[model samples]
Target: MVSLVASSFMQVACAADSEGTSPNNQDKPASSWDDISDKLKVATTKGLSKLSWGLEWLGYKSGFGEQCTFVEHPSLAVRKHLQANLKAQDRAVDVLVASIEAWERTHAKDHAPLVLALTGPTGTGKTESSNLLAEALFKWTKRLDHSDKDSPSGLLVFRGEDFSDNYTNPVSQYQEQIKSRLAEHLFRCSGKALVVFDEVQKVIPHTLDVLTSAMSSNAHLTYHRGGVERRIDTADVVFLLISDIGVAKMEQLLIQYDDRRHVPATQLENDVKRALDAQWTRLQFGKMVRQVVPFLPFEPQHIVLVIQAKLDQLSEYYQGVYWKSLAFDPALAPHLSTLESMLYIERRAVVRGVDVRKVFAKYGARNVETGPLQQLKSKLMRYARPWNPEAQFTVRLMPDERTIEIVACVEARANDQDKANEDGGGGAIDTLSCVSRWQGEFT
Candidate 1:
């Protein structure tokens, strides 16, 4: 395990060093596709590392390759698409958009067209990848260190709001205007282009048909307006159709087919995942299967992974330093969990309007002095057991994970003993004392 971790660290270090190209320096054309692929692999690996870092912080090992995975397009397919659309007129604009420029140069222009779609459920990051690809192509080559899945980048996205025209009538009027405006923007930006249609299913069929020609035939979609017809050039654009309806439908089907009542954790996670997969199986859009990316719903485990990953990064950056001197304080664990639960669940049950202010101020320690940190301390105190009416339970962080486990058992027994002793006179043997007398018990 030590050797594996050491090797992983070394790879991360090496990737970081290579990522830092001087800002003034421009990316020179790579001699071969292999070189680009190798470089891209490093970037891809680094991107995954950040994702894993977030996962580990949530309290679990990264399952990126094992379960949480993204789809990848082959260099050959990408190159073929690029070469076919990249002509002399598009050379300047297309170069900036595509990373696999070398392979693209080899393929002939004006051949069979290429159209790629990125379809998935809501929040699975279909539109997000489009933005990331755009940013990687046009702005910085490296992915951002701190980026959310929903973070947008270089792609030009058109939402349903953009097509705010009468759907009852032919969409030619407003759809043409939208296409014309969008085409002008892409044409002006001399580089590779990406067009994302979020919730494409909501779009009118005629509008979708217009897009089909531009995507499949590599032919420009003409929009007639004001005595002239304008063409939206899509030869160099990667078209993406993102949707959630398919996944929603699949979820409904699963709810019916599988028993929804009293489902086990394993079954719940699997059913949700199966529902997402079914979405792809029932895909209806024309030739959408060729470009489909079935996004799975995030399971609790996934969120746990992200949190654990974040913790790992924090641990590394801090040189394994605990957040504070008391971060690991054993007293803090149970209290922390309790505090979190109190804050998260049944907010009304834990803290509310009047209780909120009282929580910030120590119950009896202070006479309502308003100090933020102290108040925070008071609120967290709610998690601790109220023993010895006058004594405040000292919240401590344990350095060892084992210490936490052992202390928890001790605390449980102590609470029971304290309750039992409460009936007895003030001077009495505590639970810890009784526990210490046990011959076989290990501390």
Candidate 2:
């Protein structure tokens, strides 16, 4: 910011002095007022832009990128986010932050991407925590769009299971495909890039073997095509590998130590690392990890917190962007119920792994793609089971299913006064009770 301010001032000063006549000159040419005026306009615009940016940096303005960075230590910000959004990973948070910081510093000179492996249980925030690191560096995490065939440059996402199924694709061909696809993105990006590999456990050893070459001293993958070596640069990149490889086992380990309360991070890290290492070894994926951040299973309470965070987020979003006249109950219709009951419902939903934001989107009350809530909405969608918006649904229970469907989407008839009157002023159910997590799978 200091350099930016100084640069702006210099440009202004240079522009002002470019056509000025000397005061002592005997004969002087007429100065073009238009040119001077244009310079002033440009200078003012640039100055104001810089000034606004400075204000944002100084906390006087709310700008997109400003609030996401580290004030001094990025780890502090990362910790703050995790402590607030996640639970029972205080030690993991420190290790993760320290790992990333250490890797970045060393990798700048080493000329290879720093690779991190995040292993954890299903609902734990391993991926979300990685994203916190992403936001710290890039001001915002650039999400890879699956819908678009053309991925946005610099950020590429690979899902492990996509290349799985040996019957469908031969291992040799799959390996080549993985290498070539990754190489394509790596070469296209200028300078450093961030590539995230999610569900790493599902990826076959042959496909992940591409990493051995990518993480080499030269930091480039070599592929022989037509008897010529073609190289793709990956030296100046960051690779985050997220997996549930030992997740179930890790969860079991943590549960064994649940009552200990003061279990050391080093011990937890070691145990989880062993579990993940066993998986990696069993899968025959050779060692390539510089750091391993093990995300433990969140206590059921933590899921409640994450769900509550989502609720608070929605409240803020609606406050900021709610259309004044558009009122027909919030996406959470039973908000009119007692606050205690409403909270109970929300918490129960969280325990059930029901993402309320997706529920909102399901009812058409929320347009998830067009607001600040998109990130939260996206995360919620991941846990959401598919539901048809147009089809009429029933509330009856099926004995064949293990998971209970809590279908509560009721369109308001307030807009249609006739229907409202017929139903005795909108017959909305307000009863909310907690249900235990289903022990088995349900469709």
Best by TM-score: 2
lDDT tens per residue, model 1, 32-133: 334546766675566677665555433222322222111133244434433343221122123223433432453256522244444434444455455544
User: Model 2 scores what on Cα lDDT?
Assistant: 0.54
List residue ranges in candidate 1 displaced over 4 A.
1-114, 139-154, 164-170, 223-233, 248-289, 309-443
On residues 5-107, what C-alpha lDDT tens digit does candidate 2 reach at each position? 5776677667556556545332443444565667767766777788776765565223233333323454566556666655446666777778767765676
Indicate which candidate wins on lDDT.
Answer: 2
Per-residue lDDT, model 2, residue 37, is: 65
Error of 2 at 46 (Å): 9.7
